[model samples]
Target: MLSGFSSHWHYLWLVAASLIAGVMNAMAGGGSFLSFPAMLSMGILPVQANATNTVALWPGQLTSLAALKSDLRKDLLPVAALASILGGLTGAEVLLRTRQVTFLHLIPWLLLMGAVIFGISGPVSRWLRARSAEPHAKRTPRYFPLFCALFPVCFYIGYFGAGGGFLIMTVLALFGVDEMHALNAMKIVTACLSNLVAIITFIVRGAVLWHYCLISMVFAALGGYIGARYARRMNPDVLRRIVVLTGCVISAYFFWRQY
Candidate 1:
């Protein structure tokens, strides 16, 4: 049995981290920078921590998908759905098979990659937003090409998603879907669906630590709700910068920890 005060502090730490993660997610879009590390700090194994983090943050995406369901393009759905399912399942299975220490060593590099991707997205997002107002003829994207573009990113999402959502949005924009509504909607659907299968894979493989997962999920949900209320009042650009900075800082910390 653990010492009483120490155990209480551990839970309190998780609660604080999860609340901030939820708020960050609702405000900007980088909660994993907080929640995933919180899982690691709890002494959970690397693979299980990643799986639990994915599971914990998933419910929020469902609400987003529901709210944005109307904006989803029927044409793109087939490609996004197929890619997310196949890639996510494959990624989760691969993660499960990864040796614990190997995953541990990879944490810094993965976090760095996510952070760098997020930093680049700031410009891409603005470009997409500006491009959204212009009218363009509808173009049909080939299923195979679109699937090829999305599959590896979806696999990264299932494996250790931090900033993969923007990558999906970028891919969609490149495929001639510049409208933010559709891009955002499809990103959430792809993420939610992909994460859904990974969640199942982790659960079946017995990789998630349920007690922490449940707590983080509940508190993160609460945080999202609270953050949503104030999201409109806050400046999105500022929030985005903060999130980017947080990801980079966290990535650096992980690098420091490893080396």
Candidate 2:
């Protein structure tokens, strides 16, 4: 649908980008930072870029779901999906009602903070893991705070998802969900819900680039499938480092350019 690139060349890039995006999304959460920028650089405008990126990411979620259907904890999915969907809807309404230029100015700083928080997550998690073996009763108050904590984060994802994966990972960690496969599963489901709402809102506003979305979804799906299949094979810690570094660089680039 996107003219200029030959079918063969475009498909290659599509698969490459989607693969990168799927792996990044599963491992960290900022896959959009990669896919969105790539789209923009290829000539799509901001609004269209956002819409197309949301649609593109759906496939990644689907792929992840298919790959991890067995390992998924069904109990958490309903609540996470509800929270993400409701928050996303609210975010879309707020975005529709407000001016976004102010938020754009704030994105880099927010992403930088997210990156820093994510970077220390490993160490903090290690420390927490050290303080082990508490009674189940004692842990309730310790971990229960995280469900309510997602308010601002999921709302932001619905509004703008740049560093959302980082936020999701952080929230999951807080809630005592530490396994990468489980976390990835949660991310995929929650993201799917969030993006579904955002995509609908964007479509109503006529913001989506259908051609770009169509092409990108195919690649993103494939990438997500591959990542899901091989998720257990890679070192999750290394993947986390790569994602954090990417977020830091992207945040810095935007901060320098805009500020």
Candidate 3:
């Protein structure tokens, strides 16, 4: 255990951080960028930070899932759960096999692309909004196919989770899922799979700091709960814009620094 009152202070900081992470995660997926860095700066070892962050994410996921329990009933829950399990396992396996060095090379390009896509999200949403009065039946075939194609997005979420929310939102929209439900369900399930699988894998590899993970998880859960509660009151369009802008800035930084 951490000595003195510093441990409690750490917990408090983590709680606040988790709250921010939860909000960002519920609204987008790049919340890790914040939480991970915070942990690193707090003197957590690199591997420990990663494992702890993943573990902490669990609370947030559970919170989000609980909030959406009603809508996630019937066939949806089972299928989504199955998908998360399978996809998360695959992603963890891939992460294990791959070297972080490879990602270093790709980060720049990925960020640039993310920025471009974010820049266009507003116009895309506007176009869709204009068509709100039209029968969406005609667009089903084209859109559904595009959405299904994004199943691989889960793999990436499991691997990194940098901007998985943006990808999910974009893909879900293409498939014609309503914005709010998709955001809620996607955040919860994705977090479940990504965090659980990664935590298991990292633990087996001896990559975790159990004390830190426990502390972070506790706070992150609190954050996620508060975030979900807050999201319930916000406008999707407004939240989306904020997420997009933030994503663009992150992507730009990656592009310039890594590329």
Candidate 4:
């Protein structure tokens, strides 16, 4: 009884972290940089923390999708959806089979990579925008190539999830999707689908902490609503910088912990 009580207290911060994660995801795109490390700091095993984080944030991603429904392009939907499902399932299987020590060793590098990706997102977005504006520019790559590219990205989403949206946006931009709203809309759909499969896999494997997942889900959903409503008022560039800094700090700390 006392242990359960203490466990509850230990997870209180997950609620706060998830709320902030939801807001950050809504405003910018790097919530996992916050949520994943927060769980790790609470002494959750790396794989369990990742699974729990995915379950906690899945609802919020769906909420964002609902809010961005009008922005989604039908032409880009079917193939990406298939890739997301297949890749997510494959990635979840891989994660479940991985040893805890292996995941722990890989955490720092993954976090660092995620940080670098977030840091350069703005510049990349601008470049994609310029390229999209050229009169003779190719609007999209052939469908097969785009589908192939999204496979690895969706796999990463199911495997780790941190900064996955940024990766998705980068791929979409390369596919000639330069409109900010449209890119975000596709990101939301793909993330939601990918996370859905991951969540199912984690649940079946008993990797998620149900109590923590439930609490975080509620708070994240609330944060998503508030963040979406106030998105225009927030400076996304500032939020992006903060996320990048936080990712760097978390990565350094995890490196120290692991080594």
Best by lDDT: 1
Residues 1-259 of candidate 2 have per-residue lDDT tens digits of 4564565565566557766887677655567657765665556655456566777786566655677667665667656766787788887667655544665566577668757766776776565454433322222223235546665677777776665655676677567665666666666667667877877888898777777787777767666666767878888788878878987898899789896
Q: Rank the candidates by TM-score, best first.
A: 1, 4, 2, 3
**What lDDT does candidate 1 reach at residue 119?**
79
Local accuracy of candidate 1 as per-residue lDDT tens digits, 173-217: 999997889999999999888899999999999998999999999
Where model 3 places Cα greater than 4 Å from the true spot, the runs are 1-16, 26-29, 42-48, 73-79, 100-151, 169-187, 225-259
C-alpha RMSD between model 3 and the true structure = 5.3
Report the lDDT tens digits of candidate 3 across residue range 1-259.
5565776676667666666777776654456655665565467754456556776775666655676766532434444455556666676667666655665555445545544554566676566455544455422324334434444676666665555555655565555654455444654665466557766877787767777677666666666666666777887667666756666666566567655
* Candidate 1 Cα misplacement greater than 4 A, ranges: 1-3
Name the TM-score of candidate 1: 0.97
In the range 38-123, model 4's lDDT, one tens digit per residue, is 78767888889889988988877666678799998788898789889998999898998899999999999999998998899889
Looking at model 4, residue 240 earns an lDDT score of 80
**Residue 13 lDDT in candidate 2:** 62
Note each model's CA RMSD in angstroms. Answer: 1.4, 4.7, 5.3, 2.5
Order candidates by lDDT, high to low: 1, 4, 2, 3
**True lDDT of residue 59, candidate 4:** 77
Query: Alpha-carbon error at 16 in model 1, in Å?
Result: 0.7
